[model samples]
Structures are given as structure tokens and as C-alpha cells.
Target: MDKKEISHSELKALIGKSPDLLLIDVRTKEEVDKGKIPGSIHMPVDSVDRDLALDPAAFQAKFGVQKPSLDAPELVFHCQMGRRGALAVEKAQALGFTKARNYAGGYKEWSEKAGK
Candidate 1:
């Protein structure tokens, strides 16, 4: 499988350009309470497999957001650092989200460059 990685700046640019993009925060709830990239959906890494396994309608009902289609334009995952985000992206891909990617810099680099 082809894995993709996005940098902070690239993700910011894509956010502006891609209407179909889905930004997922795979951090713990406590970590997420501190802060996160604006507009990111909070889906902890640990829940990804179970959540993505649900059918699209059920997934949306549970998460309050549309389930990304297999051909969704882009789905970017991030965590406090990068490891969990990479894992989340892999899980997304395994579940057939072909456009999934890891935001390698994650929230740490984002906060540094974009401010808290």
C-alpha cells in the first residue's frame, strides 16, 4: 500500500483548498482538551478500528460526522506527536480510505508554527 505523509504547512494549505478533506485527531481525550488543530474531528487512535468498521450511516450517527468514502479526497490524522497519527493513518488505509495520510509533525509542530 502507498502511504502518504503531510507536513504542517502542507496540511494547512490543503485545508484551504480541499473541501472534501477530513482532519482527524487521534489523541487521547485529555490531550485533546488542551488543544487541537481547528476543525479536526476527535477520534482517538484506539477507537479507529472499531469505529471505521461500522457502516457509513452508523459511523456518522455515532461520530456526528460523515464517514469518509473510500475515495474521499483526503483524510489526515494527527496526534500530540506523530506515532499514533501514523498508526491511525495505517488503520484508515487498511479500512479502505485510500487517500488517508499522517500529519507527521502532528500538534507539536503545528502549535509551534501556528501558535496555540
Candidate 2:
């Protein structure tokens, strides 16, 4: 199985059952001002490179979510569609977050299917 991406259904299941999962909404602030997946942390795609490098305490203060450790298994990124999310995942993986994954369907598919 490809480890670089996650399906919407898989993400939904994780939302229901995985306390450790981290859902990062990497769209622009304007796009996010409208809506995002429930419980996702809003971190725009531009800031991901800088923000993900912060120490845990600084990360929490800035993003209001605990920083995922280098190997956090359920770390996932999404955007309006999927392009930015893939880029975000690429940045994360490059920074040693090898377990980070893209939500390939993005919020379009999520909101349509999840009806939010």
C-alpha cells in the first residue's frame, strides 16, 4: 500500500476512532474561513514549512495544537483540493516527518461526502 496518501473514508474513520491523529488544513486562510474538517488545525500551506520546524511549545502556542513528533503516525494534511496538501506533505516528509501523509481527496470530497 502507498504510505504517502490517505483516503477520505480512512480519514473519517480516524476522526471517529483515533485520538492521536492530526488533521492539518493547509488551505489559505480565506478558504478556511468558510469551513474545514471538524477538529482539523488551521495552518495555511505557506506557513507549513516554517511552522513545522518550531519546538513543541512554540508550535502549540502558534497553531494551538500539539506538534506531531517526527514519526507521528496519523499526521495528515489537506487543502481545498489536493495539490497544496501534497506539497505540504512533501515539505513535512523532507523535514523528517516521514509518516506525514496527504488527504488526496481534500476538503471538496470530504465536505461533499461528509455533508458539512
Candidate 3:
């Protein structure tokens, strides 16, 4: 499956189906320190540029785990809003992640979903 953009509702549905899906928080550590969706991996967007951008295999060997293998289990990226997370999804796809998607509306959208 090719990577593509995903909205908040779509991302949420994916999360429900695959709990072990790689939920990547593309926000900075400080930003995420405030709060983040549960079970997300902290893969700062910058880190991908430094190491993973240069050599993803090496990055995985050192800082990342094996790429998630489920087709429906997407590599979902989210930040405060959609832009950064959308960029992160593009990077992840460039780095050979076949199932990456952005969580547009991100944390704010997620919080709203939880309330509903």
C-alpha cells in the first residue's frame, strides 16, 4: 500500500483497529511534554532529518525499532496541527515506510474525539 494523507477521523479509526500500529508523534519533545495521544512513539520530525534522513536503516538500528509490518496498521504521524505531521508523513514515506499518513488536526482533534 502506498502512503497518503489521512484526516483525524480516519486516523482514529485506524488506531482502533491496530493498537500496535506505529503512532508517531512528530512534535518536539518539549511540545509533547505538555500532552500527546496515548501509545504514540516520540519520533521528533527533526531526528528524521539528522539521522534517519541520511540513513534510515542505520537510524532504525540505533534509535528505531523494526518497521511496522501490517498493511492496515499505518505509521500515523501527528503534531499540534496537520502541517508538521503531514511533512513527517512525507519523510516517512520517502524513507521507505509504505503506509504512512498524517493526522490532520492532530492533538486538538484527538482530544475532541475523546470527548465525544
- For each candidate, the alpha-carbon lDDT, in order, equals 0.87, 0.92, 0.72
- Can you write out model 2's per-residue Cα lDDT over 1-116, one digit (the tens) per residue? 33899998889899969988999999988899888899899988889989999999999998788899998999999998899999999999899998999999999998899765
Model 1 scores a TM of 0.90
- TM-score, per-candidate, Cα-based: 0.90, 0.94, 0.72
TM-score of 3: 0.72
TM-score ranking, best first: 2, 1, 3
Stretches of candidate 1 above 4 Å error? 1-3
Cα lDDT of model 3 by residue, 40-107, tens digit:
77888877545445454765686565545434356788888888888887776676666777878888
Query: Model 2: runs farther than 4 Å from truth?
Result: none
Clashes counted in candidate 2 amount to: 0
Point to the candidate with the largest lDDT: 2
Give the distance in Å from residue 81's predicted Cα in candidate 1 to where it truly belongs.
1.0
At residue 60, give the lDDT of candidate 3. 65
Clashes of each: 0, 0, 0
Better of 1 and 3 by TM-score: 1
**Which window of ten consecutive residues has the lowest lDDT sum in model 2?**
1-10
